[model samples]
Target: MADRKFALGTFNAGIAPFPGIVIDDTVYDARQVVPHLTVATLLADWEASLPALTAAAARPVGGGISLSGLRVLPPVTPPGQLFAAGANYRQHVIQMAVAHKLGAEGADPEQLAAAAAAEIDERKKHGEPYVWSGIPSSISGAYDDVILPGGWDDHDWELELGVVIGRRARHVPVADALDYVAGYTICNDLTTRSLVPRKDIPMMGTDWMRAKNFPTFFPTGPFLVPATFVPDPLNLRIQLRLNGETMQDSNTGDMIFGPAELISYISRFAELRPGDMVITGSPPGNGSHWGRYLQPGDVMECEIDGLGVQRTRCIAEAD
Candidate 1:
C-alpha cells in the first residue's frame, strides 16, 4: 500500500449516490472500508476519520472502478447552510466598479484601474467580507445541466472557490478559523444579472434570492480536495471557459479577504456546522462584465488548481 494524494466525491452508476475515494482516475467505494462514513458524515467527524480515509486510499487498486461511465453527484447534498461572499476578489470588484461607473467619466482606463486598485487596498485594510446565504435546493451536480429560468434571461457565470466546514465554529477568531475547514471544491455560482438590482425599489440594493437562488443555479463539485492537500488555497489558479473560450482566468491571490477572514466574520452571526459551505468570491472575468450571458446550449467548464474540473451545460426554460 502506498499513501498518496486523493479526492472525495459522490458518484452514481445506476443506484443511489454513494461516496467514493478518488485516486488518480479510479474510484473505490468508500463503504468498502469505512461503512459509517458518507461525505457528509466524514466531514462531521473529519479529524477522527482522516487516518482511516488515508489508509483506504492507500490500499491496492484492483477493486476500484473507472471514473468514465459514472455520473458525478454533488459531494454533499443539502448541506446545513450555504454562505457566499460577494465583491471579495480585488480584480473582479474593480472591474465591476469600473464597468458600471456612474461617475469619473473623464478618467483614462489606466487611471480608473489604478484608482479602483487603491480603493481595494484601503478596503482590505479595514473591511469585512460581503456574505450572503443560499438555499440548499439550488445545488446541481458538477456535470449537470444549468437551467436558465424564464421571466429572467440575463444569466451569468461566476466561478468561485468553495470552502467546506468540518468543525462547528461560533465566534471563532481569525487566527484559528482555518482549523474548522475540512476541504475545498469548485463552485459555479450562476447569477441572473437582470434581477440583481431591484428596479422596483432602488434603495433595496441586491435581491440575492431572485438573482442567485434559482433551481440548478449552483453547479458544484467534481471532487473535494482536503485542506491537507491544498496547502496554499489563497494562491491557486481559477479559470473558467464558456463555449470553449476562456472567460474567467485569474488567481485566488487577488482575493481581498481570504477564507480565514470570511469564516471568522460569519461565525459571529451564526453557527458554522459540519457540511456547511462558504463560497469565496469570483475573480475578474464574468459574463455580465463582458456584455455576454448564458444562452441555451452553452457549455461552461470550470477548473481550480488541485481540485477537479466541473463541466455544466446550459438549457433555457420553456416558454
Candidate 2:
C-alpha cells in the first residue's frame, strides 16, 4: 500500500472542467497522463485506470499547478444516477422523531432515548433502507455557489458520505457490495423541507424530487478518495458548519445502515452503474432541528475525513 493515497477531482483551467488528481496543495492534471480520460470515464474503467492514476500521483510536481485560484468542479459530473438514503442514521431518525413529536409525547427523556434505541435495533434486524433517487442536474461543485430557490424557505443541509460505484451491479449482497465501490466523496444533501410532504395528496407521502432536485441542491466533492484508502467509511467524522457556527457534528458510525447495506439494498431494485452515487444518510443535527434554515448570504462548510472539504455560499435565486 502506498503511504500517500490518491484522490480525483475536476478543475477548470479555462472553460471546461478537466479531471485531475490532488497531491497535497497542488493538482497534477491526470489528462497529462491519460489525455482522453474524463472523470466519468475514469470511474467507468476504474480498475484499469488505478495503476495509471497511482503512477500519475507519484510523479513530481514540476508540471503540477498550484490548487489556489483553480475552480473546482463536482468530482463526478453528470453522475449516472443519484441515490440518497433517508433517515438512515439512528440518531438523526431519533432526533427528527422527537423534534416532530412523532411518538414520544409526554415521555421522559430516558424513556424516549430508550425507545429510540429499541426502534433502531428493530429496524436493523428487519427494516429495509429508505432509498430515493435524485436528478443529476441538481449537482454543483464543492466550491460553487448554492442557489436558494424562490418561494422556498426551509432549505436545510444534510452532509453525507457519498459512495461512487465503479462497476455495474444488480442484486449485490451486502457482504460483496463494497467490492463494487470505486471511492468516496462528500455530498451535502440540501433539502427544501417545506416541499417534502404533498398536502394535495397527503397519502402519497414525501416528494423527494421536488424537495431535493432543485438546481445546486447537492454540493459534492473536492476530491474522490479511492475506497481502498478509506479503511473504514463508517468511522469517518461528518461535520457541517453554517457561516462560522458548527451545526452538524457526528460520525458515520451512527448510521442505521452502513455503505455496504445501503448499496446492497438499492442494487436489488436498480442496476447501479459506474459513476452512480449512493449517498449514505447524514448523521444527526440539521437546520430543521435547530430552527435555523438556510438564508441568502450564508456560507456552509462541510467536511468528511479524507474526502476533503466543501465550502458553498448561498445566494437567492435570480429573477
Off by over 4 Å in 2: 1-3, 60-62, 104-110
lDDT of 2 by residue, 33-84 (tens): 7654588988888887877788777664448877885899889865679999
Lowest lDDT 10-residue stretch of candidate 1: 101-110
Query: How many Å off is the CA of 220 in candidate 1?
Result: 0.3
Q: How would you encode candidate 1's per-residue C-alpha lDDT over 143-206 as one tens digit per residue?
A: 9999998776689999999999999999999999999998999999989998888989999899
lDDT of each: 0.88, 0.89
Error of 1 at 78 (Å): 3.6
RMSD over all Cα atoms, model 1: 1.8
TM-score per candidate: 0.95, 0.96
lDDT of 2 at 245: 89
Superposition TM-score, candidate 2 onto the true structure: 0.96
